[model samples]
Target: MKKLRFSAFLAALMLTTLTACSTTDSGRRTVGQYVDDAAITAGVKAAIVNEPTLKVSEIQVETYEGVVQLSGFVSSAANIATASTVARSVNGVKSVKNDIRLK
Candidate 1:
């Protein structure tokens, strides 16, 4: 019984350590920072979806250290601009990098 318990504890410890040292596409970020960035990305996507003129499904949002990047294809220049503006307006966004292309 004791050996089984020790093995379980050791496994948990290794998992925690691996998660703490994990690197994301934009490089290393603490777990808190990663969660924050995820929130920012979700917020941007929600804002885009709420815009009547924008196609939310066509826009991809990514956030790294508060910097939002908007990608994917849209209908026009206006849509690209709107996506950038919407991403920028989201709270915790440091800046927006719009790479949306016309479809």
Candidate 2:
């Protein structure tokens, strides 16, 4: 019985810690939002990799609140346009900010 009580207390403490960490005074993201952004970033990267005209290694992807920001150097103007289109096609992307430049 004592061991069970200690275990319950530990669980409650951990839960409180996680909840507290999720709240911020600055405009920072919560834990769940961070996870969502990571998923969006991954989806954008995967989409870029699948595009035959775009080189996956040449692009960098980041996401915040469903907005994806893509930046890097590509071979041509068409590749830049293609990357933007591909990022926009992803499921969780609200909008895309394409900063890709021609190499």
Candidate 3:
């Protein structure tokens, strides 16, 4: 019975160690999944600010992992396309989902 208990304890210790050692890609203190989402959000916001045809006030940016979800009203289809293109150009952006409604 003592031997079985020791084995189980060792197994649990190994699992804990492995879990603690795992980390995200950035490797900056492993801020967890929220950090990745925040990075994408910041990237999208920066892209929108730099895009000539897309006004920052007219769009909302939400990010999950590296995928960006853009939703809002824009002046024209060209503006929407421009926004999506701009968002895609941002670093660390895995995908762009443009859900902007044309006004």
Q: Total clashes, candidate 2?
A: 0
Candidates' TM-scores?
A: 0.74, 0.81, 0.68
How well is each residue in 31-69 modelled by candidate 3, as lDDT tens digits? Answer: 456677898788789878887777999999997778899
Q: What clash count goes with each model?
A: 0, 0, 0
Query: Where is model 3 more than 4 Å wrong at Cα?
Result: 1-30
- What's the best-to-worst order under TM-score? 2, 1, 3
lDDT values for all models: 0.89, 0.90, 0.85
Candidate No. with top TM-score: 2
- Give me the displacement of residue 13 in model 3, in angstroms: 18
Query: Tens-digit lDDT track for model 1 on 1-103?
Result: 9999999999999999989777765677877789899999999999998999998889888888999988899889988888888888889999999889998
lDDT per residue for candidate 2 within 32-86, as digits (tens), equals 7788889999999999889999989999999989999999999899999999999
Better of 1 and 2 by TM-score: 2
- Full-model lDDT, candidate 1: 0.89
Quickly count the clashes in candidate 3. Answer: 0
